[model samples]
Target: MNNNQNIAETAISCSGISKNYKKVEAVKDVSFEVSRGEIFGLIGPDGAGKTSLFRILTTLILADNGTATVNGFDVVKDYKKIRECVGYMPGRFSLYQDLTVEENLEFFATVFNTTIEENYELIKDIYVQIEPFKTRRAGKLSGGMKQKLALSCALIHKPTVLFLDEPTTGVDPVSRKEFWGMLKNLKKQGITILVSTPYMDEASLCDRIGLIQNGEFLKIDTPDNIISQFAENLWAAKSENMHTLLGDLRANEHIKSSFAFGDSIHITIAENYEVEKLIEELKQKGHKKISIKPIKPGIEDCFMELSQSA
Candidate 1:
């Protein structure tokens, strides 16, 4: 295929999409596209409009303005076609909790006018992990098992596009890793995926990501490209009195910004700032075992910078 053909084969497209509820603007003129078989991520925190966007694209809710399409079908004009071709796993567990895992999967397959056996290979990897508990009620299963079951149900229909809203939230770290692995396998099947998550670490796993906040997209690009846009000197600082280090670092005039990250404080310093001077100042303020080192910015750091500017 030529360049134009590749560009024209988009699986998802949104143009100036906007939505509001009562007095709150849930989504604000968001626009983007996902190429065929690409993994596009909506990276943001709770109430940042990720869920709203997913709902709009999934045809569950109408956007107040703008337009969107999935699998080349209009979200509003061809809602039926979009529904038939897309698989959506909502942020919450919306599956049949009262039914057994196998029963729930069978029900969804029947609803979609298909059967589990018809697409068994599509969900085999995920389903096999939870197959031992196929007779167990979905509600009684562990967090990880429930996640896998939900994924299996979503894939049973062989959708061209998949929308997963925080599919790994509340699951163990191992489960999250495994779920992403399942997604990778699905990508190999030529399925386009649009997943949303608040976890910054997961951003790097996608082909591209949109950093969203306050109902707006701060930036959208590949993870590495976004990190490249962080035009500031970042440093990690830690002291014996870790709790008080953030305030002290922020109080310094040379420090542009300071935020606590795990055991250390990540700060952006002025061009003329000297690390030795800051360390000495902290030591004078009764902080001991001070440590400071320059570091590369990650997705979280990039998000912070973009959100602040937005």
Candidate 2:
């Protein structure tokens, strides 16, 4: 491993972390670390144990096996200290619905034994966007505004580490972009952030990402590194008949895997197969006006490869 790959003084650390409910395991032997001041993302689809791991790290729930720590404080024994040093914004908006935005902020600050003015600078940038609606009830704000408010409240305590559980899940595209910008600003202020999201596009925004599925972490690395590790030659093929193109590609013996992307089907061809041979085969399958070219592997592509191999 390179120097950069070596784990630094981690803001959060977990080893052999496992959790379960009844007969099902929510997280299985998951282990990874987030370096200080870095934005580490947990990328996976729903029911992939992202929230379960978040709950354990935030001290909201206990892990059934292994151990974890935040800022060198054990999550179980030092729950209070860990809670004080980290801000957790759950996937759902859990702020008081009846309280105004300002009121909600004040309440959270008070709970931390601090005042809004004391931590005002920490959240000033985000708060400014929602300041105009300070008097609006939390329940009345739009999805974007509510997200900002929730984030502001979480930062009111000036936590050293921030845990955002799918913070942009339901927000609009513009708001999702805005929220990531806010996280970048927070990173500049030296706050280590651990955010979970199902969006593969957002994976590139993080310094490093842990791709989790079926309650286990499959791989962890920088987005570019992960994409480079995709060993197969990938191609994006499109035809006039999109549906038939997918079925035809799948039926081809030379094709390893084929899945529909936005405007094309991302395909991995078998080893030792020339592009010309594959094109000829597709053409014989009645895929006229076909376009096939090798394309760069994206985060989603890497993710699909990992899941398929697993």
Candidate 3:
């Protein structure tokens, strides 16, 4: 990856990236690439080492092994260069909580040796939303507003690539949706984004995603591709006694996998199931309101299956 690399080429690349914390392996030989200007997602649950990997890539910390490059600059030798070319939002809100929103934004801008006015266009859409409360202390902002202010500050210097670590972990549903929308808009402006999120649903919004688990990548592909590769027929199973139903479904000889999903259970059948016969069997076992129907696999389903296999 070099300056000549276009929007479609790789803007970020990591080869055998790994990090360890005493006894625990935080990242293990994780490798991937993010094309320039693409909204590439690193999807996994918390404590899966997402933050560790993000720290290494964003130059906040060094990996014990392997190499990575952001904007064609090495993570080690070109750390300073990488810092100047990328913007990072950590999992935690790290802004000056006591400072006014405007002050925080200005502080970040000055640290980068740039003025807010110099890159105002890059952050205008996001910043304008929070500008009305610019004089307010950042600690007093609502979750959504705080999220917006953080994003505005991240973009204050207009870096070529952005790294967001679990950006939507604790926000409200609407705010999460709004934040992702902002990322979509940023993509149109040709800024490559590497966003990590523990939310499975958000995985579909990325141009491509790398599914990680326990410090290792289980799979990497477009969401649709990952779902298409799901191994078995899936069914949504529900009954009055949903808890017991899960155990019963898992005990069934023909069932390959069974797990609770929301109010219903997602089941992967080992072979063709006779729906009517299965219902009759459950009824004989005293299950009422029993309903089972074939269901399409989503990112969560794919993740569950991969995790089990891994």
What TM-score against the true fold does each predicted structure earn? 0.95, 0.96, 0.95
Per-residue alpha-carbon lDDT of candidate 1 for residues 84-185, written as tens digits (9 for 90 to 100) = 888999989988999999999999999999999999989988898899999999999988888888888888888889999999887777878878988999
Give the runs in model 3 whose Cα sits over 4 Å from its true position.
Answer: 1-8
Instruction: Give me the displacement of residue 189 in model 1, in angstroms.
Output: 1.4
Write down the lDDT of every candidate, Cα atoms only: 0.91, 0.92, 0.90
| Cα TM-score of candidate 1 | 0.95
Q: Which portions of model 1 show Cα errors greater than 4 Å?
A: 1-8
| Native-referenced Cα lDDT, model 2 | 0.92
Ranking by lDDT: 2, 1, 3
Candidate 2, 258: how far from true, in Å?
0.4
User: Ten consecutive residues with minimal summed lDDT in candidate 2?
Assistant: 1-10
lDDT tens digits, residue span 1-310, model 2: 1422332478999999999999889999999999888999999999999999999999999999999999888999999988887999999998999999999999999999999999899999999999999999999999999999999999999888899999989777787998999999999988899999999999999999999998998899999999999988889998889999888888888889999999999999888787789788878887788889899989999999999899
lDDT of 3 by residue, 121-180 (tens): 989989999999999999999988898899988898888899999889887788889899
Best by lDDT: 2
Which scores better on TM-score, 1 or 2? 2
